[model samples]
Target: MADHHHLHRSTKNRNGFYVKMKFFRTKNGKPEKPFFVKHFKWILWFSLSFYFFAKFLNNHESSTNNNSLKTSIINHSHRALSESILQKPKTSHGLLNDLKVYIYELPSKYNTDWLSNDRCRNHLFASEVAIHRALTKSDFRTFDPMEADFFFVPVYVSCNFSTVNGFPAIGHARALLSSAVELISSELPFWKRSNGSDHVFVASHDYGACFHAMEDRAIADGIPEFMKNSIILQTFGVKYNHPCQNVEHIVIPPYISPEKVQSTLLKSPIDGQRDIFVFFRGKMEVHPKNVSGRFYSKRVRTEILRKYGNDRRFYLKRHRFAGYQSEIVRSVFCLCPLGWAPWSPRLVESVALGCVPVIIADGIRLPFESAVPWSEISLTVREADVAKLGGVLDYVAATNLSAIQRNLWDRKLRQSLLFHDDVESGDATWQVLVALSRKLGRSHRRLRVSSE
Candidate 1:
């Protein structure tokens, strides 16, 4: 009876209230429990309760500390750390769900035959060729269309280069692609089986499936009716209400010759001293024309030339340079102003060579934003803010330039922006697979099993 008497505990809980409890006898009492059996349930209950309470408090405190640490990193002065909020990949999330892709073996006329033009597989717009080449040899590819999660349509539309100008003449793109779709729809059961929703097409050109270089014409034409329901992997994207990108699509980076980027890296290491302050060597016409009621670069190029053309810190040129990739490696900031289209190859080239890209295109949606920290790695100057670019860039150089450079030079980040002949882990091709895996809800195979 004395051992079972209630007592007041001086120890307070988190609420600062003293706890009252009964004392247990260890020695003075008769062995009614045999010191164990009689009160075994209470002892076990108290022990478990204490353990659970301790674990709960520890978990709550640990979670709070972790969240505070993440907040501390984001609020740090190095602006690049602000990427902690963006959905950037902490890991590659490699080959999610064992995703499988099926490549439609259309006649050589639709794909491989175009490779006869050596430039077809190596040009700036050659992603249409590279992805297909890589997929045929990738683990994701399956010859059995029945087990495929998504069907890949390989059509080389950007290969018909004009002899006179050496630029891709894509006038026949719509008809050529239309023919391929017709062949697959009639003979193959896959396209019709899924209503083309599980099929994927690559439009590595100026305006995506609109298939025109001119934006006005591209928008007027719009994504083809046949391709509207299918998935399109394209380079053309804008964060606006544009008809050209109204269909299901993923923004992909334009093709940049990996060999050329590698060659430039060999000549000048990414960590090498950048001699040029600001570099641009593409077409910056002194007098741009309003072709089809659109001025070249929308006068953005001319504005850049007018404002910083003579400034020693800004190196602007109007002519073509073959060794431009080498120059990019030796530059601090590379100008990626809008050309005929909002997207440009310079975005990839500059990043690969460790040059900070000064993007002047407004509303441009970059590729693999989830994998590549675009906001942290590059500077985006709106088209309206072109005149003040000098001040803006100077401020960045003074404030967070090193942080941005550190993010840009990350080898895996840069590799995500270029397509290699083969799929390397975390490369652009692999990133595409990761993206497709997230869209597995669209897989007809999964739907069939669930419904059945």
Candidate 2:
């Protein structure tokens, strides 16, 4: 019985040992799926989350860099544009830098044929040549009207007036002016651009004021109806009373022949003692029945002749073309009386010869008043003050008179009153061009603001 019990115990012990060995093998071999298989879905979720987060960070950095680059480019462009705007206007020959003018091509009958006529080749035709030459020689002319700052109408009103049978054919002149204006308005896009504001017309004739002929009144009234809105470059820019008076219109100097100008310029400057105190040469009386009638009949000339004809201090002579410059050079002051018009070539001639001009014309508008101070250079007398002419001049201090003479000899002032071979900065033609440029720039600025 003892032997049987001991064998049973041994068997139990073997079974226990086998059971422990099997448990150790299963634990060691399988490894429990590395502790992740128990929560496999959670592991996959964490891995995918990490990958997407990393990708989003990379894209954000790239976008920030691109935005910064775009901002830098925009800022640079704005700065460049601002600098360009603030820069000074470019200058060429000291006038308008890049200003362009386009001259309208009209039929010869309108301008060329009449201007080329021998009778019209005097002072009446001078402006046409000088203006054309200046514009052509300078860099300001453009063949295309679209590129031009000003549209120049080269019709010579004075030349056209000469074409008619009678000298002062008010009806015929008006018709011709109206026709030219109508043709340009109808055919070109430029005239209608600024309602003819940018278009320039020359009417330097003494009868320019008569462009608007009133059949009943028999005189020019204001400006021609068609030209009221246009820029009229005229000699008849009278201030208060007479027609063709406009602030918008430019008053131009009369055309003195280059030959006459050269000869007068060659003379020595006025020095020491000039013999005559004042000089007058021209028609002392006019026919009562002239076209302008009482308007042309300036009694001031006759009154002066009557008052000072015998006075040794005041030299008075009937109209004589010869030795005119010699007489002017001999005089201290030249009398510029109103004749047919308020403006005369004599005023310019006196200025050329450095003689102090005693202006007696009523309502006269001097040229280049902006650049040249006429009041400082010349003496003005009223039409009613004819008897006090001597007293008026005598009242001026000798120091003041000497100063006026000195100012007349100034290179700049003399050049401003005349035309040059090349269109210079302060010359009459250049001054007109500068005025036109300013007008155009203002118009352009207005357009830009309206568009914005």
Q: Model 2: which ten-residue window has the lowest total lDDT?
A: 67-76
All models: lDDT?
A: 0.83, 0.67
TM-score of 1: 0.79
| lDDT tens per residue, model 1, 1-452 | 43223323224442222222223333564322355767899999999998687667656655676433222222232323333445353333244786878787676888888888899988888998989988877767655565788989899999998999999999998899899888788776778888899999999888999999998898888888999988899999899989989988898999998888888888889999998989999887778867767887989998888888889998888788787787889899999999988999999999999999999999999999899999998999989999999999889989999999998999998789889988888888888888888888889987887799
lDDT of 1 at 242: 90
RMSD of candidates 1 onward, in order = 17.4, 25.5
Error of 1 at 344 (Å): 0.5
lDDT of 2 by residue, 1-452 (tens): 87545644453587654644543344555524344666899999998998677557655654675433233234434533555578643345334646777666666676667655554545533675567657755656655455566777776556544344545234455667677777777766666767877777777666454453331252535466667677777766667755445436777887776566667556744453578788888878643324544534357877787778888888888866765877777778899987766677778778877788899987787888888878877999998998899888877635588888888756677677776556777887888887776676534334554689
Q: Pick the candidate with the highest TM-score.
A: 1
